[model samples]
Target: MKIIVDAMGGDKAPEEVVKGALNASNNPEIEIILVGDEKKIRPYLKDSDKNIEIVNAQEVITYDEQPVNAIRKKKDSSIVKGLKMLKDKKAQAMVSAGSTGALMAGGLLILGRLEGIDRPAIATLCPTAKGPILMLDIGANSEVKPKNLVQFAVMGSIYSKEILNKYNPTVGLLNIGTEEEKGNSVVKTAYSELKQISSVNFKGNIEARNIFDGDFDVVVCDGFTGNIFLKTVEGFGMYIFHQLKNEIKKSPRYLAGAALLKPAIEKIRSSMDYSEYGGAMFLGIDGVLVKCHGSSDSKAIENGINVAYNSVISSINEKLREGLKSVTEKGE
Candidate 1:
């Protein structure tokens, strides 16, 4: 399988991105095509093996640039070129740590959506007490209908089972309370519809607090709520770590205790690290589009490429097609 990597999309640019592509290319069966300025990317290729190649992309889509406008004007941009490779079947998937807006816009405009999908949702695997729980619409469609949530549930379920290797993953609708009538009209209507889908294990409403408690395997919500929820967890987690370090520096006794607890602390931090989980998949898209964090390091980019490879090997899109059809037929 061939995967395209946006070598100039992240904060570290070609260095970190190229390192990641080289690391992922250790698998003989996988060929990685790096998309960026050839001059910068070539130097990094010296240590890489035969599985690596480069495609020149002169322009880049920055975070400040308007997504649609950048995509339209910058025809030779790394994001646009990488996505085109996937669309043209030159690559099975595309991975980028660039601007999320540009990636989403280019995905819709260039790659299009799946056959029966109304909208594509961003699905991220978040750490939970039980394990990694897949959440959808993390920042895709700010406004959505009950039908959209229903589709997200279906897509998330198939992804959980096929990629995450979860069996009969329990699906939940994120809401203010666990009650059926707890949320707004969109979620309320979605709850009613989710319960009727036989293909999905639709659990009742899931509150924000219980997200990491691991009770639900898949949680569905509007992009607005989901994006806020994801960012808040990330920020709070970072804040806690910072506060702990400060507390440990207060005295040698606290420092001693911190050293004793170092392993446990590192384990927790690793679980919460965004890089460990790789990239979020733009589910329901015609071609695979994985979005890494903007500040992703080499390890994160490698993990992202691994995810893209797994999705292709597992035939994730085909499974989604079948799963969506099954759920749609059941709902009808």
Candidate 2:
């Protein structure tokens, strides 16, 4: 399958993006299409590989630019072009480390949403206390309606079951307290609806602080809250890791323990990096769309490629079409 990669997005720009895409393309089973300025990309790529191609793009949207506005104005930007290619079926999926808003807008505006799907939500695999956790709406819809939350739950459930290998995964609503009446109006409404859905394994509300403690398999919330929650966890993980290292460096006994636990610490730290989990899947789209981390290295890019390939070959979109229709028919 052909997977399109926007080579202009992220902090490292063309170099890291190019290397990541090239490394992904190394897998003979898949073809990688890099969308960016060909003149720049060509020089970085010494020669040609059958699996890789550079599509010329004139402009690139920066993080500071308004996502939807930049997407509309920069018609030749790498993200928009790659999105168009997905719509045209020139690629199975589109991967970008660009403006999150622009990518979401382009996916809906260009590729369109699936049938029976309202707003699309972003779901990323996260490392949690138990194992991998699926967090929906990391940064898709900031403001959400009750119905939107229901849809997010539906989409997130399908993802957890199909892609994450979770059977009847416990779905949790991110809130301040574990009780049903704990959160604001949004959570109060969503909790009632989610609990009513018998098909889903609703496990009640999950507080933000215990999210990494693994209270549930899939956590659902609006992008606004989910984004804040994600960032806080990342920050906390980094702070604690650095603090532990600083302490260990000052004492011999602590340093000895640190040496002994280096492997275990690396494993834990790597698990929380978010990149190790690959990209965030844009649910409710007509096709799979993954938002790779801006600082994604070769391994993360490779995981994104594998996800794209599996998404296409598995006929995931087609299955979602059927699954969603089934749920609606059942009045879920």
Candidate 3:
């Protein structure tokens, strides 16, 4: 499998991205294509690395630029070039730790949406107490119709089952309350539609507070709500760790206790780390696209490449097309 890495897309560009791509290239089955300024990306590569290739992309799309405009104008940007490679079937998938907007826009404009999907959704895996839960529309579409939510559910369910190895994954709609009567008009309508879909194992509404329990394998929500929920969880995790460190330093007794429980603490920390989950998958798109966090480090980028590799080997887009077609046929 061939995978493209946007070497200049993230904050740590070239260096970290190159390192991660090299690490993933160790797998003989995969070929790594690093897209960015060749001059900046070459220093990190070893002469012995034969599986890795570099494609020169002179421009970069910054977060400041409008997504669609940047994609159109910056033809030589790493984001655009990598996406174009995927569209041309030169690579099986592309991974980027760049501006989320540009990646989404590039995916839409270059690869286009799958036939039955209205709008592609971003499916992010969040660590939970029981295990990991998949949530969709984290930042793809802030506003969505009821039909859009139904599509999100369908895609999320297939991803959970195929990639995550979940058996008959149960999906839940993120809402303010657990009752079907709750939420705004869009959600209420979505709830009714989701229940009628026989393809997805649709559970009733799930509140954000109960998400970490891992009762549901997949959670569907509009981008506006899903983004807030993801960010809040990240902030709360940071706050807890920070407060714990401060408290441990203040008291000798606490310090001793913390030292004794260091192993357990590290385990908890690893579970919550975003790098462990790799990156979010842009589902419903015509091709495989994985978007890493803007500030992702080498380890995160490496894992993101693995995620893309898995998606490609699984032939996930083919499955998604078939799944959506089946749903549409039944509805019609």
Candidate 4:
């Protein structure tokens, strides 16, 4: 299997991203094609070999650039070039630590969506209380219709079962209240539809506080609300890290005890790290499109590579296609 990576998409540019591709290229069967400025990548990239090759590109889309505009104007941009590798069938999957909007737009406009899928949602893997839970629409469709929420539920359920091995994965809709009648029109309508699917483990609505409480295996929401939920967890986790540091500095005795628990604390932080899960793939797309964090490091990028490779090996797109087909046939 071959994967295309945008070498200059993240904050560290070609350096960390290139290092990641090299680190990930250890898998002999997986070939990696790095797309970016060859001049800059050559220095940072390790020994030139058969597995990892650089495809030179001229420009890069900044975090602030308009997604559609940048893709249209910057013909040789790293994002577009990397996507083209997938479009041309030169690569099985594409991974990029670039603007989320650009990747989503490019995946839909360039790589295209799978048959029977309306709007593609970004699926994020999170370490929940029970185990890893799949959350859909982390930052894809903000204004999701009731049908979109139902679609996310179906997709996440199948993905979790296929990838994470969660048989009969329990599905929950993210809402302010747990009661069936305690949400807005969207949640109310979505809850009704989700209940209609006998295959789905519809467990009722989920509150953000209960998200990490380990009640369900999958959480569903539109991109806007899901994005807010994702970032809020990230922010709170970081805040706790800083607070513990400050408390450790309060006294010598506390410092000694803190040092004892430092390893455990660090492990918790690492467990909460989003980088460990790799990029959020735009599910329901024709081909696999993995989106990494804007500030991802080499390790994070490797995780992204592994995710894309696994999706290809596991036939994630094919499973999603069949899943959507079953849902549509049910007329739910």
Q: Which numbered prediction scores highest in lDDT against the true structure?
A: 3
lDDT of 3 by residue, 54-121 (tens): 99999999988999999999999999999999999999999999999999999999999999999999
Q: Over the stretch 1-332, how does candidate 2's per-residue lDDT look in tens digits?
A: 78998888777768877777887787787788899998878866866566898789989888888877887898999988999988998988888878888888888888899888889999987777798889988889999987788888887887788787788888888889998889899889988888777667888888887777876889999999999988888788889998998899898999899889999999888878777777888989887788888777766776776777777777778877887888789887
Q: Model 2 Cα displacement at 19 (Å)? A: 1.5
Residue 206, candidate 2: how far off, in angstroms?
A: 1.8
TM-score of each: 0.97, 0.95, 0.98, 0.97
On TM-score, the stronger of 1 and 3 is 3
Residue runs of model 1 more than 4 Å from their true location after superposition: none
| Sliding window of 10 residues with minimal summed lDDT for model 2 | 41-50
The global C-alpha lDDT for each of the candidates, from Candidate 1 onward, is: 0.92, 0.84, 0.94, 0.89
Candidate 1 achieves a global lDDT of 0.92
Instruction: Report the poorest 10 consecutive residues by lDDT, candidate 1.
Output: 323-332
Global Cα lDDT for candidate 3: 0.94
How are the candidates ranked when ordered by lDDT, highest leading?
3, 1, 4, 2
Please provide, for model 4 over 221-309, each residue's C-alpha lDDT reduced to its tens digit, 9 standing for 90 to 100.
99999999989889989998999899889999999999899899888889899889888878988898888998999999999999999
Q: Could you give me the TM-score of model 4 versus the true structure?
A: 0.97
Please report how far candidate 3 places residue 132 from its true position, in Å.
0.7
Candidate 3 lDDT at 290 equals 98
